[model samples]
Every structure is written in structure tokens, then in C-alpha cells.
Target: MQLSRFTDYTLRVLFYVAMNNDRLSTLNEIADFYGISVEHLRKVVHALAKSGYLKTFRGKHGGIRLNRTPEDINVGAVVLQAEGAEPLIDCSGLDCTLSGVCNLQRALADAQRAFMQELNRHSLADMLDNTAMKQRLIGKAV
Candidate 1:
């Protein structure tokens, strides 16, 4: 199934925060660092903050930081929340015409559940478990 840009950006933003660790990373800084659009990243940051994934502050020293440790942020939870919709296939619906006529709905639901269960097996920290790889992503030691 195709995931939305929101989920993609959520993962990227989480990785950026994980790379910075304790450093209070800002939207502008991350946008520049990744050469991405600051405006787009800001939306992702806002959603993350609203979901309790990140903490935000105001003023000259204001920035974002992880509300939980990288280990605590489950990849599946992040994706589920970031995507903001059930991973149901086109056949899924409360009153789906094919609900009882076809098996696709149940099959797709099972697959989606399996997908999330697999994702739950890993965390943001698991994405870059190696110190060298983590450093490479951040371009420095945290």
C-alpha cells in the first residue's frame, strides 16, 4: 500500500531529531540541512507536536525536541498516527458493498495488521543502531 507524504515526513523529521539527540533542532535548521522546504517541514513538525511526539517552545531560543526517547517511539505508532488513517484497502468500509460478497476486505485488513505488527518490531533508534551510521546521517557525533 502507498503511504502518504505525511507519514514519510514524520519518519524523516523523527530521524533528524534522533540525530540531534539532545540538541534543540529548529525547523529552519532541518530544512536547510536536508535541503527541503521549510514550509512543508513546519506542517510535519506541528502534527508531531500535536501528537505528543515532539515538544515545542517559543522565542529566540525556542525549538523542537523529542517528547520521548528514540527507543520509546514505536515506528508503527508513529506511522499509524502520522498517516492519520486506517491502512484499509479500497474494499474496506462499514457498509462496504463487497463486505460479505468478497474476501478482499478481511484479507486486506489482516495484511495491514501484519504490516503494522512488523513495524512495531522496530523503533527510531533501531533505524540507526550503529554509531557510525547514525553519525553519518547527522554528519557528526551526537
Candidate 2:
């Protein structure tokens, strides 16, 4: 299943913040690096903070940071939070005549579950294990 832009940005924000766990990271800095909108990241950050994945600070020296360690943050859990528990196919809203007879919904649901299971096998720390990627994302700072 394809993830929404919101989920994509959510992962981006987490990666940026986790890489810079030594200090707080500003929304503008992350947006500039990813060429994303600060306004959009603001919503993403707010949601992350509310969900306890990120901690935010205010005032002159304000920014964001991961509330928990990278190893403690499960990729599947993060994706689940950003994407929600919605089924892969929203058959409820569709008036499909084969709704009861079709096994497509079940198949899609199983696939979605398997996808999440695979993601659950890796943590944010596992993703960050690539030094080259870290260097590319945050230069030599990481």
C-alpha cells in the first residue's frame, strides 16, 4: 500500500530530528533541507509531539527533538501513528455489489499487515545505521 504525503513527511521529520538528537532542530532547518514547507512540518511536528514521539521547545532557543531514543522508536509504530489504523481498502463507503463475495479486501488487509510486520522488525536506529545516509542527510554533524 502507498503511504500518504503526511506519512512521508512524518518519517522525514523523525529522521532529521533523530540524526540531530544531540540538539534541538528547527522546523525551518528541516524544511529547508527537505525542500518541504515549514507550515506543513509544523502540523506534522505538532502531531508527533502530541503522540509522544517528539519533544518541542518554545522561545528564542526553541526547536524539536526526539522524546525517546532511536532504538526505542519502532518504525511500524511511527507509521501506524502517522497513517492511522484505517484498512487498506475503504469498502464501507463503496457500494460494491461483490463486497460480501470478494476476497480482495481480506487479501489487501493481509498484505498491509505483512508490510507493517516487516517495518516492525526494524527500529529507527536500524534505519540510521547507514553512516553514508546520515552523512548525506546531515553532513558530518551526525
Report the lDDT tens digits of candidate 1 across residue range 37-127. Answer: 9999999999999989899988998888899999999999999887755647665447766666887767888998899899999988898
Put down candidate 2 lDDT per residue, 41-96, tens digits, no spaces.
99999999999999999999999999999999999999999999888887887889
Q: In TM-score terms, which candidate is top? A: 2
TM per model? 0.84, 0.93
Local accuracy by lDDT, each model: 0.83, 0.91
RMSD of each candidate relative to the true structure: 2.8, 1.7
Candidate number achieving the greatest lDDT relative to the actual structure: 2
State the weakest 10-residue window (summed lDDT) of model 2.
Answer: 133-142
Q: Residue 65 in candidate 2 has what lDDT? A: 96
Clashing pairs in 1: none
lDDT for model 1: 0.83
Query: How many angstroms is residue 69 displaced in model 2 relative to the true structure, after the best TM-score fit?
Result: 0.3
Worst 10 residues of 1 by lDDT: 84-93
Predicted structure 1, TM vs. truth: 0.84
